[model samples]
Target: MILTREAITTAVEHGDIVIEPFAPERVSPNAYDWHLGDRIRVCEGDELDAAAATRVSEHVIPAEGMVLRPGRLYLGVTHERTHSERYAQMINGDRSLGALGIWVHVSAPLGHVGHAIRWTLEIRAAQPVKVYPLMPFGKIVFLSTAGATASYQHLGHKYTRTSGIDISRLYEELR
Candidate 1:
């Protein structure tokens, strides 16, 4: 089942969950809001190869903000690094951002029980929209697993310890 705000607090208190730079005010009734990081990476080529698409251009959002255009994928990172040793995590686009036609994640929003990393957002815009760094753009919800699960660390996941926008590692994993 999905965890409640109190449950989340308890999990953090018990060391089952961790949110670096955790802010009490960012926690909602069921999820916690996450802000956008300063850097963004956009793929440089028109054709993308799942296994070897390292051609990307990185940009930093300025004080005035950056414009996100449609038909392009922008990889963004969350300002907070989150991890849960006992619970699975899911990141979703904040409602306000969704209403503004901003999708913070695509299909890779789910995280394993032992996942410990800052989220790399699959950002896209439905239209031209200005976004600022440190903007609350995503919400993360924790879920309880039925039984004990293996840790992502021990599982050798490619995206386990990512610090910023991770380019696709599919090719390396497939080799």
Candidate 2:
């Protein structure tokens, strides 16, 4: 079941959920609004190979903002570091940003249990859109799980415990 704002607050109080620099005002009815981190990475090559480690160039979003162009994949990070061993997480771009043609993620949105870190945002703009550091970017909703669950950390995932924007690690699985 999806957690409500009250449940989220209670979970945080009880240590079932954790959000660094938590703000009560940022909590919505069922999701928490998260901000954009200062750093972002853009793919360096025109041709990307799935079996090879993707090359990316990291850039710090300036104080004014950075413009994201169409037809380019930019990896961004959330400002908040969050974790929840007892619940699963999913992120989505807010409608306000969506209307401006900003997609916070391309495909991956599900967060595994025990995968504690700042989320890497797979960003793509339908048009040229300017984004600022620490700007309200997206919302993350938590869900309760039933039955037994395995920790993502124990699974040896390549994207575990990330601090910044992480490029595709699918190459590791292909090896």
Candidate 3:
């Protein structure tokens, strides 16, 4: 079952869900709004290979804002670091940002129960759009899990404890 806002609050209160730098205002009815971090890595190659791609240029979004052009992928990070001991976390694009044609997290949106990291956003724009650091661009919802589950750390996942925008680690698996 998906957790409600009250349940989320209760979980936080009971030390079940952890969101760093938590803000009361950022909590919605069922999810917590997350802000964009200052750093972004824009892919600079024409073709990308999941097992070989590594060419990217990092840019720090200025306070004024940075424009995201169409047909380009920008890997961004969330300002908040999150962890869930009991529930699986799912990150979704904020409706306000989506209305502006900004797509966050292209495919990988589900996180494991013990996933602890600052979310990496697979951002793309339908058109030209400007985004600022610390802007609320994503929302994370926690889902209840049943039975025994393994943590990403326990699994030795390459992207388990990332603190910033992490380039695809699929290449590591290929090794």
Candidate 4:
């Protein structure tokens, strides 16, 4: 089941989800909108395409963010880490970022732990910095649709949970 705004609020209130310097208004019907931190790494067109086949060997983070003036912000999404089988698909969007007004995601897949996604925010000047895990994906999408789910318990009296979302079918729907 996709989480509702009430569920999101409850989770945050109960300490199940946490985003530093959080705002209640950011919570949406099914996800939370994350603000752009003062940092980002923008891959060139070729670099962005290359990631589809090979991950980048070099990550260039500006010493400070670019073009950022005071109090301006970028927006993005966050994923709930409750489910261990973390899967994320972030597509681009259109929003003004001073002059470089393209949208992007912050993600490191597979065996990433301790490592973080860094970004640079350029307004009047550039200042590169780091942001932590997001609570939701910028409230852009909750799910392509309500996710189907199922769970079971183990014989040892332990409650082991599971999911039943058929991703293959989900893909067809998205396309």
Candidate 5:
């Protein structure tokens, strides 16, 4: 019971969902594209060998640098949390830092887990971001399609798409 564009549009009209500083060009038929922010926190430490990268402890090696270098991972935010929901957390680098590597952590499916969120992300160096990570990404409208259909047969039901695939295809379509 994923939401349709029209339902989402109407929900946005009523203020049930919110998004700010939207760019006019990125919305697609279903979801809006988000931008990267410039305030990145790098996880610096002993040059990690293959096994030391993943499973980073709760500790963080604070960085003062701005640019995300290759092979280095970063601590960042999630697309799902709001200012009210997210709590500060951190993750370590993956030795395989490059194209197709993780840019963040996903503890549960997206949307469902954000209500009371806590998890960290590991960002990679791929492009120049125009905003700050503290800023929210994507837009939200009411999305009537999530709980019901147009036929009026099934109404007020909740639905969610897999967060994994929603983003995996983003780069494919962008390319």
Candidate 6:
């Protein structure tokens, strides 16, 4: 079952959930609103190979904002760094952004337990859209787990304790 806002708050208080720089007002009915971080990354080249590591270029989103265009994949990170030992997490793009043709994540929005970090977002737009640093862009929902649980650390996950936007490490597995 998904956790309610009150349960999320209780989990935070109990140390089962952690959201850095937490603000109570950002709490929604079932999720917490997270903002866009200052930095973003875009992979270089026209064609991508699944078995080779791709090159990426990083840029800082100015306070004035940045424009995202269609036909390009931009990697972004959440302003908040969060983790939950007691619950799994999933992030979804805000409806406001969706209406503007912005997609915060493509396919991988599910976060594993004990993976503490600012989430890396797979961003794309159907049309040009202006997005600003620290703008509320997505909401993260927490869910209760059943049976035995193991931390992501024990599982040897690839994106461990990432500080900013992490590009695909899928090539590592293909090698």
Q: Which tens-of-lDDT digit does each residue in 1-175 have in candidate 2?
A: 9999999999999999999979999999999999999999998778889999878989999999999999998999999998988899998889989999998885999998887989999998999999999999989999999899988877888888688788888888899
| True-structure RMSD, every candidate | 1.1, 1.0, 1.0, 11.7, 12.4, 0.9
Better of 4 and 5 by TM-score: 5
TM-score computed on alpha carbons, candidate 5: 0.41
Local error of candidate 2 at residue 17 (angstroms): 0.4
lDDT per model, in order? 0.89, 0.91, 0.90, 0.33, 0.35, 0.89
Rank order by TM-score, top first?
6, 2, 3, 1, 5, 4
C-alpha root-mean-square deviation, candidate 1: 1.1
Stretches > 4 Å off in candidate 6: none
Q: List the candidates' TM-scores in order.
A: 0.96, 0.97, 0.96, 0.36, 0.41, 0.97
- Per-residue CA lDDT of model 5 for 1-175, tens digit only, reads 4344554444445644333434434344654444333334455565544433332323222333234455755555434422111111122222333233434443322333122222234455555422344343333222222342232112322222222111122333344
Alpha-carbon deviation at 10 in model 5, angstroms? 1.9
**TM-score (C-alpha) between model 1 and the true structure:** 0.96
- Write candidate 4's Cα lDDT for 83-163 as tens digits: 212112122222432224333433312111111122122212234423343312133323222254222121221112212
Candidate 3 lDDT over 1-175, as tens digits, reads 8899899999998989999989978888999989999989999888888888578999999999999999998999999989987899999898798899999996999999899999988999999999999988889999999898888778987888788888898887887
Report the poorest 10 consecutive residues by lDDT, candidate 5.
82-91
Count of clashes, each model: 1, 0, 0, 24, 4, 0
User: Model 1: per-residue lDDT, tens digit, 45-118?
Assistant: 77888767578899999979999999998999999999988999999997799899998787898989899988
lDDT of 6 by residue, 1-175 (tens): 8888898888888999999989988888899999999999987889878888878999999988999989988999999999987788999898999999998886998888887889999999999999999999999999888899998856877887678888888999998
Regions of candidate 3 where Cα sits further than 4 Å from its true position = none
- Candidate 5 global lDDT: 0.35
Of 4 and 6, the candidate ranking higher by lDDT = 6
* Global Cα lDDT for candidate 6: 0.89
